[model samples]
Target chain A: MAIPDNQGGKRAADVIVTALEARITSGELENDKPLPPERDLMEEFGTSRTVVREAISSLANRGLIELRPRFRPIVRKPDYGTLLSATGTIVRYLLNEPGGVQNLYQSRVFIERGLVRDAALNATKENISDLKAALLANEKALDHSEEFFRTDIAFHGVLYRIGNNPIFPAMHEGFTSWLSPNWARMTRSDDHNRSVYLDHKAIYDAILERDPARAEEALIAHLSAAWSYVEETF
Target chain B: MAIPDNQGGKRAADVIVTALEARITSGELENDKPLPPERDLMEEFGTSRTVVREAISSLANRGLIELRPRFRPIVRKPDYGTLLSATGTIVRYLLNEPGGVQNLYQSRVFIERGLVRDAALNATKENISDLKAALLANEKALDHSEEFFRTDIAFHGVLYRIGNNPIFPAMHEGFTSWLSPNWARMTRSDDHNRSVYLDHKAIYDAILERDPARAEEALIAHLSAAWSYVEETF
Candidate 1:
């Protein structure tokens, strides 16, 4: 394969990535297959050892390949860590934009509704205990604003864990953590507090009762109110 | 802060990352703020220049900071590239597991249904036309598998763009591009051709008809059948 000139803001690493990714995605470079030696890749790509190392390192960081000492790098599938970090980054962008947080309520509503539905379907006795623990902690730490936020996160984290899907917990964690302190203060108003607390309680109760439809409805109601608050405030 | 000793199998870069991340996450260091000079940081962390540069580079690559020439590194808000790269990593992982293709169907159902719902509410005539063009390309490329898949991706891409949410398009692109082709071929059977084609037609009709509920239902039904096929195959 002819190596394209590293122009157009493309670097050696990008060249390697584009080539290797195509091969991997095309099924020509199957999983667990050892890649060409660094020297061989260097010659093929017509780059220095440093460039090849950077490319491989980048791939390894993404969990696309594993580099073992004294052996050729091996391709591995990516994982949840990659997704969590990526989602967190995206949510952070939304949080930073003007009026972005105000608009996020719709996306948040959809995710929470799905999460609550799964939680209702999958919540076991142990999961209930975990949820209760988080709720109790939240109640106890209400006076300590930061701790209150932490407990609040714990509550939602437990809910996602109980939902039986790996993707939701990370998304929840990333979104909540990225916007905690500001949202916590937003919830401090008397009207926001009463409405939010009640909505959370209703959703929690629906989960405890193992009613998927009710759980979804309660979560949606909660988010609708929350979105209204955001709209009015922002 | 006490500097943790780096042992065998851990590089100075890893140590620097752990310490810096702890400080950053704990709010000892503020977001969007610049770090101390490299010389000063190296002195404080008791690490080498190479180690400090590697640490900062890693952070920069992850969208945590931006390295400026002749100046301190500035903390950055999360950027889109990082988010896309991260999601690609997650899809890569999902492709590695047994019956991984089915999980993609689950994700598709969860994500695309919501995407099309919002798209129906938000899409412009220009966006709808772009989507139609993509669908036409998909139809024409039916005999060429690679071209068909590429156009299939473009079709979804147009839908995501129509949703007018930055998060969804980045995520949709990452998942589509990073997914394993072997896993995708599971749905390439002739039996699915008629069902998928008709579902796409219905979805297109709903979009053109500007019926949000019908659009969502059509997309969900399409994904649900895709999931069913995956389950049977696996």
Candidate 2:
């Protein structure tokens, strides 16, 4: 159970991290269970408290454990949100690079084009009703720019969710976070808000009609117009 | 520049991290420049060596700096590769979850569909020639499964690079890494390899003809067939 002392402290902590990660991932250490006390971990790994603490911090950063202020770290299962948690930092960094915002926005348009097509071809009654509700909320919030923006995002979010895949929603959330700064900088007037709402409405109508080509066309047009607005700000 | 002592060691480190990060990202610190000596940082931030080290480590993790065993940490301007460095760990975790592989594969298909269409619409003469070279290499490597597999990836990779966006190539790398395990487990045969080669040829031909719809059809057909092969092993 002893870790090699010849290696540096970071390597020693990494060894402990790998061992504990295997246990947590393989379910040998059950979720919600407090990992063995720090003293026991220190003794068992033949490492100092600092090494053990570093290992725990590393695990927590990887979303494999939950650390509390005065308690042993508890094993936790990672979900999509936890899996994508680091994306925010990376994306924030990317936003600073030239053309980074446009590239990201183009990627969003590409993904949403597929998503809206899927919604048209595969949306169920329940999905349509959800879209309707979102559309209504968007319409109601048209006069309130901040509310309108939230509901506007919500309406497009429904398209991402229509595929019933967890990855898409997480991706959509990432896009929203990454692109919001540009969207926020755009000059938002009643005319712009109304245009965006109508674009959403057109997308919804195409989905309701179950026309994949039309849905894709509407989505591209909407995103292209949105990009023009964002482009001006940039 | 004393950080509030009451906020604890972690918070004190974070305070130092924020100030250093601002200096680095604002280009004031400049890339490849050695950070101030640990003793100087300690005095400047009114913090201990451990706190300064922790801040340096955190910055390194976020791809903001490069750390060496005996040298001062140097600032790094993050690039696409560094920004996506964390994706491998998250993807490895996701592949362990039920349906994770298929979800990722479907997302790849969705992205590639858009990519192939873009390729058809916008590929320059040089891009087409690059793709042709990759295709020829793939054809030549057909007899060696390992080499063929690599060339096969390289051929598909050409499509990713055709768009001239750094993000697409990085994403293609991510999909390649995430999906390779499943692909590696699948049974490889001469017939299977030939079929995949033909699929690539058809996609290339469509792109050559400047037919977006035909290019997308070829891509979907190719990926669907590939998915079936993968599904059988699962």
Top candidate when judged by TM-score against the true structure: 2
Task: Estimate candidate 2's alpha-carbon lDDT, on a 0 to 1 scale.
Answer: 0.82
- Candidate 1: regions farther than 4 A off: A1-106, A117-151, A184-192, A204-221, A224-234, B1-60, B63-78, B86-104, B119-133, B183-192, B206-217, B228-234
Which numbered prediction scores highest in lDDT against the true structure? 2
DockQ for all candidate structures vs. native:
0.17, 0.32
* Share of native interface contacts present in candidate 1: 0.24
Count of backbone clashes, every candidate in sequence: 1, 0
- Could you tell me which residue pairs clash in candidate 1? A78-B93
Q: Can you write out model 1's per-residue Cα lDDT over A16-110, one digit (the tens) per residue? A: 97788767656687888988788998999999876776677667555567655456789854555445543543455456676567445455666
Report the C-alpha lDDT of model 1 over B109-221, residue by residue, as the tens digit: 76776667666767788988887888788787776666766776777878767656566666675556554344475756544554566778788889888787799789888
